[model samples]
Target chain A: MWRDHLTEIIVFSALFLLVSAMGFVAARWRAPKDMAHLDEWGLGGRNFGGWITWFLVGGDLYTAYTFVAVPALMFGAGAAGFFAVPYTIVIYPMVFLVLCRLWSVSHRHGFVTPADFVRRRFDSPVLALLIAITGIVATMPYIALQLVGIEAVLKTMGVTGESALARHLPIIIAFAILAAYTYQSGLRAPALIAFVKDSLIYIVILVAVLYLPYKLGGWGSIFDAADAKFAASANPNDGVLLNANNQLQYVTLAFGSALALFLYPHSITGVLASRNRDVIKRNMSALPAYSLLLGLIALLGFMAIAAGVKPLPGAKEGSVDSNTVVPVLFDQQFPDWFAGVAYAAIGIGALVPAAIMSIAAANLFTRNIYKEYLKRDASPAQEANVSKITSLVVKVGAVACIVFLDPQFSIDLQLIGGVIILQTLPAVALGLYTRWFHRGALIAGWAAGMGLGMWMLYQIPNAATGRKHFGGSAFPLADFGFDTKKTIYVGIVAVLVNLAVAALVTLALRAGKVPDGVDGTEPDDYFVDESDPRVTPGPERDADSAREPVA
Target chain B: MTAPDPEAPEAPTAARSRAKDRSPWNWLLFIPIVVPLIPAFFNGDSPRLFGFPRFYWLQLAWILLGVTTTTVVYQMTKKKRGGGR
Candidate 1:
């Protein structure tokens, strides 16, 4: 078993080296003279054209967790896991209209984070601070999910042991490589590396999808076996597209996840990095193709079950951890060299998102919270420095998540993030059009939404451990005496409360004669294109323009 | 003919009026609006939808049909969101 994982070790090292080497050279790919600006460090010089933006955002949106977890959920719960497919398919066109406008306004105004939009659009720093804090807090568990993805791959390769120190060394080394480049090269690294990451992921997934099915019977046999297995189960509602008990959870998770996808700081980081409105628009139209890929990947769960693919050497029998299902399938079915390629796909996938997310969160801290409150006159170099340090600290926190926290709990934190960030939707998403809601009311609305969402989330109970921070098992509807055993997304319920409060408070505040915050933008900003002079601003000062790329 | 440079002078009308000829039927995007209810409206165990079981095909079928529903709804909200289709 010790020697078994050597192939994964070598595969992982090669991928790390490749992404890192590309990261070192990325400053030249776009070749920004000034590394001091947030645009360069945090958003990859804000010059990514449509094709680069497509691959970068595509890699950013779909992560190692997605590749592992979607299939894992399918393996455990029959068809219920397939909700990811419909949610992703629907998310793009749903947001396509809104995001282009956001891109337009942000580019025109020099906004680095979504909170910048909230601050200006609502004309309230309180609203901006709330959104910034929500973005950072929500991103923590999403980063943790990447660690979970890495851990699952590690376990599949037979790398875990009773020795805790030895078990986590792979992640420690991977994150170290991740932290070094992010600290040195910033967003450019992830931008360059995403091309390699997406290429490897697509290749691995395509091979496994077609090759695995052929080796273990065919599509017809696989579906029949999955249906039979789920049919004999005790839940009784487990085998179809939509089951009665899980239907609400499915629909809400789908809609709620779609809303949350673009709201995550990393998502905004990806879009804001694009060169122009057309890049954002064209990419959204093409991005849904990933969902088509997602549908097949979710079906990998059923395929695993059909092939009678067992868990890794470490896991208990019949109690195969669903997260390891994909890893084991590749390990069992493919040759050692090919398994190495699949392992690298998952590894590089984790690295790209982890870097992008940390950078997104740090940019929020530096721009909205730090500069707005503590260091008002901080120059572009100082701002970039603050972002770099915060990125390192956030990576440390993500490592802590993998070492100590339950992976499922990390998923719950992500759900809570969706709920929290959706509060910004009314202000950020709706604010893209008009400023009908007063700034003070928007703050109150944010407070109400966050409070209501957290209270609902806290009431959820996880039966496995009887602990409750956040998760589906603890959904408050069951405890409220209305007792319908249905689970709905806390974020959806919370966002509704937020919108209602914002509307009501807006009417009240408009009557109370409250002054709204400043608005120095025009609608023309939304239609601004690549050649616009406003995009260039001025030369940002930095000391390291002449430093050699770290080799 | 000139290429009508996207960066050329913007006529104010072109900038703000992606919503110009607003038809009353534009609101019909909200129609199926409620029609996802038809399958659940029929409410059956083995009800036939065309040749296939309503249970198996309804949710899957709605996926394709839902895109049409979304495009039409977006046409109005597109104006509301301040842009073109």
Candidate 2:
């Protein structure tokens, strides 16, 4: 059995070696004149220009899980999987305006994390701690989702087994290599490897989209097969087209996900790593090119259906893993050598974002939590060291999420993470424009949103697996008296409740004579350019301090 | 520390002018975002193009439209941001 996939294993190992070498060597690439600082280690020295920002932000947003899971979602559910397309499309214009301001403010203040901004903006350590914890909590399941994507590809190559340790040992080994490189190189590991990961994915997807359809007749036949499959299934809401019941869920999920996407610590880290405001703006227009790629990749689900792909039996009895559909489809349809290259693309795809995410999370801890609460006078080198160790601990927690929890549940937990991140929008995103929300009100709103979102998520049961609760993002609208059959995305409802609570509480606070937090940022801070005097000091000071150790 | 090389002259006057033109153009950014959120417009399969359903093809088209809108807005606002300074 292993001998048949020898070419695939060999080719996958070769490319994996190439990426690991790049990860180790990246410690010295661009050499930063100073690796001892957070700006250098965590945010790529905040000097990346257009092309690097494009790829870094692109690779950061679209992950291995996107390559594996979006298509898997399409194969499992019908039109709802396409929500990723519109969400990504809207994210560009939506963030184009917001991110430039965030970049400007962060550059001026030398903020390493989003919660750093919240802490200063709100002047409330408790609220800042909440945001920091939320960032780490929201990111854990997302990193686990990336591992699930890699596991699906590994399972297709016949590397899995019946025993629990046998199934997870290969994953543990792969993540071990990832953890080592990331701890050594920090953000540079992912920034360098993103170039290789994206090129492989582009080639694999271009070939698969063109070749798979021809092998399975054509797009016409693919849709017909998908339509026939969905029509015959017991669920009426699932089919080739979006029914009236799911249309609202699709719209709300897309909009809610669009708002939530940029608010993540990793996505913001990628934006803040750009050299200037213009790089951030130009990338917003260019980044939608990845959305186009995502739209094409999502069609692989329909192609899997046309090719008559079925899920491999999972570890549990009577269980089928929907995540395996795309990987197994590639194995059946492509040549052995090409399949190996595709598998390596997906496996390496996990490395770049996982490295970035862990770095982003570690930055939040070091800047917002460690320095803020633990040691207020920590030096820059000590901060860098703390972040490096924290990254390793964060990756271990993510691995635990996959090993102990169900993989399907990890996907739903990712959506639940989305709900958790959306609660910060009023504080982080809106705080850029105005200070009227009242930091106390923002904290209260966050609590209400988190409380309601988790409660609703607890009520949603998995229809396919017959699980009790916390299985998916869709909740019935009829519970709120809209329509008995209709379901809406839980995130949209929870965020609206968050905003409403924040608004009402703000008014009451104002009437009762509550003091708003002192604004540390100047009005001109929001529009600072690369040439601004405020940004010049941080990098120049870092460079001088870096020479102290070298001399 | 060494003195950093200055790119050009900048003052509060140029910054104020840029901020004035920037705020109104942000409202125009909402067009590409809000139009796509209403699913009723593109839910049907009657107007399939190139063997793809309406739900499929129109969503892809909107991705391009969103990029175009952002590009147009960026071009309109970027000159005032950099040129006046």
Candidate 3:
């Protein structure tokens, strides 16, 4: 038993040690003489161009969350979980259209995060604060979702074998390493490690999707196996594709996820760090290629059924923890050493995004909330220091997510998070195009939408975990007792509500002679190139950084 | 180090220079990717349509498809995008 897991522990631990050693030395990877400014610490010298940004963003977005949860969902409930594939496929076109605009505007102003863009675009620090807070709030559970992937892998290896300490020890040790290096190196460590993380993942997914089916049976036999079991399955809850109740979930989940995908500050941070608009444009078109891979990866869920891969005991017999399905599929079916490779891919996958999320969260507190409220005159070096320290704290919150919350619940929280982050779409995405809505109305709209989204999610419950938090619930079938099964994305519904409220209030405020915040951007700035001298680094204006280096 | 300007008047010239370096194989990569997609959209279950069962043939055709698509994209693109380089 230990042999199965031992190889994994050795390989993973050694790799982590090696990565951390590299991380401690990473400040010297391309160490700037004095690494005190935001440029050096926060954005990895703000010099990642087309290829580097490609690998970094690709690695960051399609993470351990996609790896473990997609298959687990497929394993548990059949086709309902495969929405991740199409969502990913569709996401490219979506981002391909929007990301370049963001890149241009961000480059023009030297915005480090989306909130930074909002503050500059609208000339409203309050609006940027709302966006920043939304980003941090939405991103917390996402970092936790990465840990769930590691835990699922650990649980499969039997390292967690009946001991609570065993179950959690790996997570804590790994996060400790993560927090340490992230504190020391900022984005460079993850950016560097992303190369190895992505290579291993491509190898694992390419091989497993190809090899596993061949080993079990051909695709024919595999799907035959899946069809046989699902048809005869004991769980009445099971279906090959989504039913009426689950249909809303599929659409809403996909749509909400698309909106949320770019909205998350971590995702935007990755985009903003690109060296040019063309890089963003190229990556947007290119990133969807992962969707092809994702579709194949999602097949692992159905493949699990075909292989007659059963979930472990303690969870429902039919409903295996969707989180464990991918790890179990690899561990059980692949060779021991190779499974170690697979485990490493997943383990490393967790780190890059966690680092980015922590960075994004810490930047928010330091820039928008702290600098805006607490210390207006903090130095670049001081703000960078605060962001670094706060990054460690953000990681602790992610760790708590794994230690306490159910893995399945984290998935749902991510979904709810999508809804939460989407409320800022108008103030953020739409505001990129126009600042027509008043800042007060936008804030009011955000509060109303967020409140209503949470309320709706809270009222609905999943039969699986049976809790009443943001994660376990879905949008109810018929609001106000309407009979339409035609449901909506919670995020979309929230944003619509947000937009309506903002417009109404904007009209009301205008009628009442109230003042709206001043706009700070010029028309050409939206189309500005990376060489525009006016780009202010961070939020401050100084000779060293007309744009805040950290921003 | 270059004056921290966001606008580059030189960008248009750079983009034009890049267009010349674009890979000839870029369109070729799509062939492999799109070929199998065709069968997936159509019925592979028509045994009369092919030698192997649709299910049996789906991914084998796809491995070729992936390799072809990757190769074509690799051949055509000006720079390595998805880690091949």
Q: Say which candidate scores most in TM-score.
A: 2
Q: Candidate 3, A445: how far from true, in Å?
A: 1.2
What stretches of model 1 exceed 4 Å from their correct place?
A: A312-320, A463-469, A473-485, A533-551, B1-85
- Writing each residue's lDDT as its tens digit, candidate 3 over A408-466 gives 56677776788899898888888878878888888899999999888887776666655
Model 1 agreement with the true structure over A344-448: per-residue lDDT tens digits: 888889989999999999999999988999987788789899999999999999988877765666888876877887888888888887888888878888889
RMSD after CA superposition, every candidate: 6.4, 3.9, 6.3
DockQ leader: 2
Inter-residue clash pairs, candidate 1:
A460-A474, A461-A474
Off-target runs (Cα >4 Å) in candidate 2 are A537-551, B1-10, B13-25
- DockQ (C-alpha) of model 3? 0.07
Worst 10-residue stretch by lDDT in candidate 2 chain A?
A542-551
The CAPRI quality class of candidate 3 comes to incorrect
For every model in order, the fraction of real contacts preserved is: 0.01, 0.60, 0.00
Clashing pairs in model 2, backbone N/Cα/C closer than 3 A: none
Per-model TM against the reference: 0.86, 0.95, 0.84
Q: On a 0 to 1 TM-score scale, where does candidate 2 land against the true structure?
A: 0.95
Model 1: lDDT to the true structure: 0.74
